[model samples]
Target chain A: MSTHFAADTTVLLGRSMRHVTRSLDTIITTAVMPIAFLLLFVYVFGGAISAGPGRYVDYLLPGILLITVATGVSYTAFRLFLDLQSGIFERFQSMPIARSSVLWAHVLTSVLANAISLVLVLLAALLMGFRSGAGVLAWLAVGGILLVFTLALTWMAVVPGLTAKSVDGASAFSYPLVFLPFVSSAFVPTASMLGPVRAFAEHQPVTSIVDTIRRLFAEQPVGGDIWVALAWCVGALVVAYLLAMATYRRKAA
Target chain B: MTTKPPPAAIHVEGLQKSFQALHVLRGVDLDVPPGSIVALLGSNGAGKTTVIRILSTLLAADGGTATVAGYDVATQPADVRRSISLTGQFAAVDEVLTGRENLVLVARLRHVGSPGTVADDLLRRFSLTEAGGRRVSTWSGGMRRRLDLAMSLIGDPPVVFLDEPTTGLDPQARVEVWAAVQQLASAGTTVLLTTQHLEEAEHLADRIAILHEGRILVDGTLAELKALLPPAQVEYVEKQPTLEDVFLALTQEHA
Candidate 1:
């Protein structure tokens, strides 16, 4: 089984990658929401709110990327739900291939799809004067962090994909994830919020993750926020993976 | 890596399954001999799909022992899976993939060598060569079903389970699937198919087992099943062509 894992996953990955390539509109739709938010925040709201030092697009780019992944992973759930609904999932399960390859293919597709959408968001940001002077190492770190976050959220998306009874319910879980960035340091510094909101904003995982990415782009010392962000991402990944696998076992049985 | 072959191609005894308060399969028994076609006949909720699912290793049975191609479904599922192919009720072809690509995907998954060659062969065998390049979503229901059947035959597994392969197809498509099933049997693949259509059962099955309320009500060959009924009268009656015959004749002419 272990021997066949890589081969099976690669083949299945090619099968789903075709789905993404043929229907490029799914990618466009995924990026549309995040790009819209980016445009709105930078053009309409950036003037009213002060995000300290650099340009507002620069300060908010990390959050927009996060939103991009949040929105993109819904397609993962949607596709998985389509498979389950269409009986294709059962067809895969009954075959003699490594079962884990089925979910891994979708998870990897999520990474690639989100990567493209994130690049699109970055290009839009660059056009809006959101410049990042950080060198190659910082950019690599940023990529690593976003990759981990995408994995965590994609695994979470699988839960709904397996358990959801309706198409709408499968992708609906991402709505809250897209909204989470707004309450964190992605849009504003946590220091400006009053009492309870400030404490909630500071302690939440999104705040640390956004702060770490913001500092990385500016070539500043990442400090302990990077650790906090990684801890949050890894912790979420472990939990989501376990839950998704459990859901999968139930469905397979 | 070595074991003796089971007595039958498919052997099940006292299979049981339940969902919450509903008892889907309450001790069902079935058997299909090697290189033969056995049709399990049942109406809705008669546990036909559940039986197929368990035999195919997709679902666990509450209680029972079953073997496919000499591999125990519960303990030696990997071996059982390697020896069986399943074509589920719905056409499981990928909508975004072309007919040939769908076949190739299954061939690759099964690790059959020269995937493209295998895909083309199946497409030709299923009469889908002309439409092989178009995505499956644009194909007719019959074409999709044929492609689904082609995918299931990737490695020529000895045992095949088809769950109502012709449930919702038109008369012409039904004949196409029936022909495909005959081809499977002639090629020495043991087939266990479930369907509610008695015409289909009589048309292809070497033996028909009627399942009702989670039990095998009757199991026998078509001749044996007919033997249980009263003898036919000797009165003269003109035979008229069935609507099915008319439909098939008309549709085949259009082709």
Candidate 2:
């Protein structure tokens, strides 16, 4: 790609970022739900739910963070739907900028906004006696994993954003993503579950991701789970990015 | 130091498009001379916007070829896009941003020198100086349309396509937009506008092309088009003012 593509994406990213900053309530709103879940689970059910050997807050924080990313990506889809409906996409498409830059701007903005929400959730967890023994390298690895995961889901959000017939349909895809954590080892141990349920929880991407992150935070030896998490993230990112671009090209054409 | 002038600003031959069973444009032909305004007159669903979208490189034609500012639109979209700007039917400005911010964003994307200054200059030119700092959500429909046109002109492209620009504006706002368009044409920018208003075509277009059933029924000057129609039947009656005349007179008086 040419330098103009970068310049154009930066300019458009600035536009989307402004939308986020202008409505600070959107970021707060995304963080609020995950923080509430953190509070509800830790204070209400923390004593009852025995997740592994460590504190439940530490174990639950990874899942909450993932939910935060999921919730944050929904707004990306909603905003993209609004842009498509507003005819601004057509205006941008007719310009000389790189076509893919438009989608990239939305995806990058989603990453930035989700990262901020994740940090906010982390700070809240710390206030609630959630301690992490992980070092800077481990923290960086966790951040890398979350970033990749957020990128994958944000691209998945792009599909509904481009093709949804209504405003609600654009955002409805996130409901399943947010609920996926509940069925995994997010709030409870998969080993405690029944046969088929445990099998499904162990096989899904979120369980692997949450397990890897929980291990990273507890300073445990993260064996093949890290590889599985990385593979899931990278695989999802590749597939979602390809599908999103194909959908984008079809819509733009 | 003399060079031959460039060819037509826009040229098309047998341009066609279809959406499955629906054929939108069927072997359309057009030629827009440099620095001239050609109004594509058509009713709703007459494929006027489709033709404009294709010429602006926003959509690909299923068949035939089109060129804008001497570059083939199909093979050289970047060149075509670089030379042309479009203001879509809906005033497609970022409603979350202030007028100045919106203009600056487009100017920066177009790589115009000193984007802030260009934005300020455009705001002044478009009579949006007072509203420059206000978000577009608060602006009147007319103000938004002006800002949309200002954004399109940020690149200083030689060719411009305005797809039913005044579609949803009030009469007063429509006149204001027409004045701005006339100013652009006077400054030597080629403009191809699609409009359903016959008077708008008569007032702004150097040539009017009547689009019917996805094809041009007639393309020529207003007088030439008038010649194509059967002569008006003469009637001996007292002269009477038209309702349009009364409306214009009343609005002018109020102004």
Candidate 3:
């Protein structure tokens, strides 16, 4: 990439970061539902759900973090949709800046903002007596996994941002994503689920990611789940990036 | 003895665009001389904005070619973009940002030096200095339009396209924007602006092109275009005061 690409992306990313700072409520709102779910499931639904040996909060933190990322990325779609509606995209396109930098700026902003939300959620998890005995490398691995997961979901958000006709439609795409964790081993092991539902829960991407993170957090020997989780995250990110770029080109053209 | 003027800063021939069955521009041709102002006059849905979009490299033409500052828009879009700035029908400023912040953002993106200084200078130029530090959401329509225009000028591009730049502004604000465009032209920038108000075109454009039915019906100096229409017969009547005169007089007095 040329130096201009990096410079232009930084400038545009500054614009998006300014928007995030000005509207603190978006970050707070994104974290609120996931934190509430964390609290509710750990407190109200904890005793009833069979989570084997570990505390339910420990078992559930990985899924709640994933949910936090899922909820946070919808704002990326909403912001992109607003920029499209306001005609700013046209303005930016006409400039001499790198074309791909426009999308990159938003993607980076999503990463930064979601990273903060994840940190906030992690702090709350710790307050609820959730503890991880994993070494430094394991913690780093968990962070890496979360970053990949967020990148995949954020790119997925860009599709509706470019194509949705209305604000509600842009953000509503995240609803199913937030729900996907429930059917997985997030709340309870897939073994306890009925045959058909269990099959789906085991096969979906979320289960692999949650299972991988759960094992790492518990300092267990993470086997093939790590590879499977990486594959899902990387696969989703590549596909979503390509699809989002196609939508952007069609719209901007 | 005067040397021939430089090649046209903007040249287009046989430009065509359509959305499915709705043909917007059909074989439209235009030329804007360097350092001159050309006004595009057309009714709603007359393809004026489409022409601007194509020239600015924001949209591709289905047929024909357009060049801005000697760069073909189809093949050399980056070079074309390097020479042009565009302000759309709506004030495209970011509402969440302060006016100064918006200008700085554009200046920085354009790779200008000392973006803060550029923003400050533009704020003063557009009489937005007082509101420079306030969020654009609190700005009036006129203020937002001025800020939008200011942002477009950050790069000091040689060619500028204003698509109905003063569409929603009040009369006073409209005059202010017109003055800014006039200044831009005087400073050797090629300007192509679209407008619905004949008076606006008359007041600012060195030449006017009337777009109708997906093509330019007539294009020339105001006097030249007037010569094309059938002359009105002479009439003798008592002199009467016009409403425009009365309104201007009243508004001027109030001011």
Candidate 4:
């Protein structure tokens, strides 16, 4: 049974990957927003913002990567909504395929596609004078962190995908996701903000995550932020995964 | 020792299902013998699709016992799924994939070996070889529906459920689909189909079950169903209005 599920997931994953490949726009769309932000921030506001010594692009790149993940997850919801509205989910359910394979295939595809978008935005950041001194192990750690984060967000997207009344409703949930990083340490440090807003920003999940990535890129010591970031990502993943599967069971029920 | 063949390819006893407070299937029962073409006739929202969904394992039944290919739907869902195929009310083919690719994908999902050959065979059988390479999004509704039905046959399961298969089809496409369904039944594939078109049921089904309000109002051959009502004239013209229009007129006057 596990073999059957693995095979079915592989086939469906290939189908989803093909869809992603054909519409280069999905990847292009995900990368474009963060690339635009990187270009605008580094060229227009880089000199003005006091992000300590080094380059402003370096500080900004980490946050841009987070934003890239936020924007990319919207496509996951959009694609899932389309598949639902198109009645493809019903078709898959009837076949002798594994039930969880359908969801896993989409989740896996989201991870792969978002990874590409992250890479694209990073390349554009390099062009804008962003540099990272993190070695192979640090890079691997960053990849793991981003994968967990993307998986968490993608599963959250699945809930809306299954339950939303309209296509706009499905993708609309991601707007707050994309907007979240700005309030964190993405652009300016939370320490610079006033009382309550600064407190809220310092406590949020994105700040720790962004701060950790920023420090890692600059070869600075990242102490507690890394642990907090992983905890947040894993916590979100667990909650969202449970919620998504519950929604799926209700839908299929 | 050889025993008499089993009751039917599909057997349902006291099958009951509900959604929240609304009971969708109220103790419905059915026994569809092997190789027989059974048509389930009902109005919209009458639980015909719901029944089909349950049989195909897409939805669970609140209460009842249903055995497809001798596998219980609730207890042995995977086995039941392995023995059946379903073509839903809408064409469920992936528009992003080409016609041939869609068939190949389903074949692979069903664990068919050399899926390429199975796909090619189905494409040729459906007379879609010429259009095989083009995306399904470019195909006409009739073509898409045909491809959807063809995909359902990839695994060659014993029983197939077609829920309102001709709902949005043109006359020509409807006839084509009917022919394909007829071919499937003739090849000894037990078929359970739901349709609003009485003429379709009359022409296709060896046995018919009329469901109203989620209960089996009547079940028999077409002649037996017609026997339940008074013999009435069916007006026909060279180019006539739809049966739905006439049905609405007659039933509406009675109401």
**TM agreement with the true structure for every prediction:** 0.98, 0.96, 0.97, 0.94
lDDT of 4 at A202: 93
Candidate 2 positional error at A23, Å: 0.9
- Per-candidate clashes come to 0, 0, 0, 0
Off by over 4 Å in 1: B1-6
- Per-residue accuracy of model 3 over B1-255 as CA lDDT, tens digit each: 799867999999999999899999999999999999999999999999999999999889999989999999999999999999999999998999999999999998889999999999999999999999999999999889888989989989999999999997887788788888999999999999999999899999999999998899999999998888799689999988888678777898999
Summarize candidate 4's per-residue lDDT along A64-89 as a digit string, tens digits: 99899989888888888888888889
* Residue B111 in candidate 3, Cα distance off native in Å: 0.9
Higher-ranked by DockQ: 1 or 2: 1
After superposition, which runs of candidate 4 have C-alpha atoms over 4 Å from their true positions? B1-6, B229-255
Candidate 4 per-residue lDDT over residues B1-255, each given as its tens digit: 898766799998888998889988999999899999999999888999989888888888888889999999888888988899998888998999999999999999999899999999999999899999999989998999899999989888999999999999876688789999999999999999999999899989999999998788888997787788888888876987798567666766895
Candidate 3: pairs in clash: none
* Predicted model with the maximum DockQ: 1
For all the predictions, what are the DockQ values?
Answer: 0.87, 0.81, 0.84, 0.79
- Lowest lDDT sum, 10 consecutive residues, model 4 chain B, at B243-252
lDDT of 2 by residue, A18-107 (tens): 999999988999999999999999999988898768778988999999999999999999999999888899889888888899999999
Q: Residues A79-195, candidate 3, lDDT per residue (tens digit)?
A: 999998898888999998898898999999999999989888999999999999999999999999999999999999999999999999999999999999999999899999999
